[model samples]
Target: MPMSALRFAAVAALLGVALAPAAAQAHRSWLAPSATVLSGAQPWVTVDGAVSNTLFYADHVPMRLDGVKAVGPDGAPVAIQNGATGKYRSTFDVQLASPGTYKIANVSEGAMASYKQGGETKRWRGAVGQLATALPKDATDVQVTYSSRRVETFVTAGAPNTTALKPEGKGLELEPITHPNDLVASEKARFRLLTDGKPAAGVEVEIVLGGVRYREKGPELKVTTGADGVFEVSWPEAGLWWLEATVQGADASGARKSSGYVATLEVLPD
Candidate 1:
């Protein structure tokens, strides 16, 4: 199945085989930046967030900005300005006051559970902390799953730096072997996949370019991580690209947990 389909399937199957690979869904979520690299005393980039049937095209619902955040080169929180939601998409602006890279992300974490209460099945979804109190005290045959998801993009003011790229050591994350803002067509870019701070080998990554609305069929490229949890991609041309990956495992409490990551990157002409 296409990565788009897997996203929805993963959520619906969270209590079953959470994060299991599945077919494509009708919509895909993404974040697109107006610019990935800039030069000036202070630069800014506008980002569009949406979940559309066509990649990067706002033909569907706007992505919620409640979890959106930005981090500067110094590992300090950067402010997101002029955030707004429209009919089909959400827009936000970030100021590149510092002369280095910045990471902008929309993150969400929650737990899903199903139980039998009063001889009826009940379903619940909420933050991990609220799982305990939200569920019935006498609920039987209870099953729970935790999930984390992140959608993000990178922008550089002067030169790209890694400080903002540091992983939080939770959920699925990208560790760039090749700087995200430095991607070039025909040149290979390497990245490592991490699951709970450790290498996540055998994970599959799906790459697709934007402008699918104008094409008869969108082409998707797939790659799998090696033992080192690293994978490489050679861009076919210059444009905005969407990459996604998902992994499932167990949390500290031995409860089933899953993580999904999506990133938008720009590839420059060779």
Candidate 2:
């Protein structure tokens, strides 16, 4: 393709990423631990990761496990060994030698796109695999927006601790209020969504449990965050849960951008 056409195509992709409706977007990728709480003498925990529309089901494309990291119960790095990427999902194991909360996190490299307008080009960056809508035809090149994303989940060894569940203040983060590792189907799980280290108000949150077939009556449950940046959800059934939030912003240039945040919770049977 010609240089101009190639540039246009790139810009179009960026716009799509910025404006795509929530319902049509791809599933937010996340990592779900096999067990959130380990008791007795177990020193190993496994995590499964995927980019599926549903929760925990590797029905969609597999997520890459290259940059996966695990922090042990003592606030130190845990060994993540034997990572395997399959056609539908990726799996890895963590060696938990102590008794505390473990944190597994992945921050993807930037995914970016740009377009030329009025003889100038603008660029955008978002969570990998985020899609944007087409740029408006009448809009000119006058702004730029950039975004970054990350995913996190926690596991408890021996006893539960909230230390590992604290927000890292990344692009978009969720601070567990109900202890992500201790969720129960009979109770509600509470979380606070934060953006740039401050309470994020009026952001939409979507929680998905297992695949569509696994849901009791629906696919995704949606809720909007209040002024406190907190939201809660009750699992209809015991299973893995995927929570996602997106925030959009624009640089001084007026270029619109967005970032995606994903977290997982393991809900046990009541």
Candidate 3:
């Protein structure tokens, strides 16, 4: 009885150990990049990483954008906004007011099924913790992160296009400039432009003196940009000349007139 009883107890214990229920674990995973930086007149941030889940069960996940912050040499939080995407991917952009330091955090609730390095599904994850680092500053060194991920990883490692908001808040105080708004006898008025205490050279200069008699000579003359982008022309007679100068391009609106600044010049009647 003693030997049989002992063997039976040993066998019973072994079966119980094998039959016990296994615990269930849930893993929340998103994505992350090694480094991110904020630079440029506007400001930008990026996250580089891969998802723990291989299946990408939730094609769509919500991400929290941070780092829209800064501190004076004293310390203060700069206000910023997390832009919206019209597609399924999650990304964020903010227009920095000035410049400083900042950070960004990303989180996901539901994760995709986990896959083995052999390209097989051995486990599944329900939750995962994913975060990205960012440094936003003005005139600062930018950090870039490079990643090597398996094609099967369910994540948007691909970067989306980024753009800056048109400069606001008294953008670039560019005072309207002017060329020599004057003219003498019918010879191009050797004129240079003026702006912000600098020569407005290399910009088109227009000379309009309507008081000239229209014989065989033209009353109005116009010149385009030359050296320094400024050109010159002559006038038939010098009097009160109506002059208009403009430099077309991206600096000022593509399609804008005068930029709301004009000048007047008097020509000696020759």
**Candidate No. with top TM-score:** 1
Q: How many clashing pairs per prediction, in order?
A: 3, 13, 25
Clashes of 1: 3
In candidate 3, what are the lDDT values of residues 60-79, reduced to their tens digit? 33333331222221134334
Give per-residue CA lDDT, model 2, range 159-214, as digits (tens).
88766666667667887788777888879878888887788899988887764564
Candidate 1 structure quality by residue, lDDT tens digits, 1-270: 112344544655532235444214556789999999999999889999998888899998899999999999999999999999999999999999999999999988888777777887667676789887887689998877888888999999997899999999988899999999999999999999998899999999999988867677656789999999999998988889999888877767767777888899999999
Report lDDT (Cα) of residue 67, candidate 1.
94
Candidate 3 has a TM-score of: 0.26
TM-scores, in order shown? 0.91, 0.78, 0.26
RMSD of each: 4.6, 5.6, 29.3
* lDDT (Cα, 0-100) at 111 in candidate 3: 21
What are the runs in model 2 whose C-alpha is more than 4 Å off?
1-16, 21-23, 26-28, 109-143, 211-219, 251-255
Q: Cα deviation in Å at residue 226, candidate 3?
A: 1.0
Q: In candidate 1, what residue range of length 10 has the lowest lDDT sum?
A: 14-23
Give the Å shift of residue 170 in candidate 3.
Answer: 12
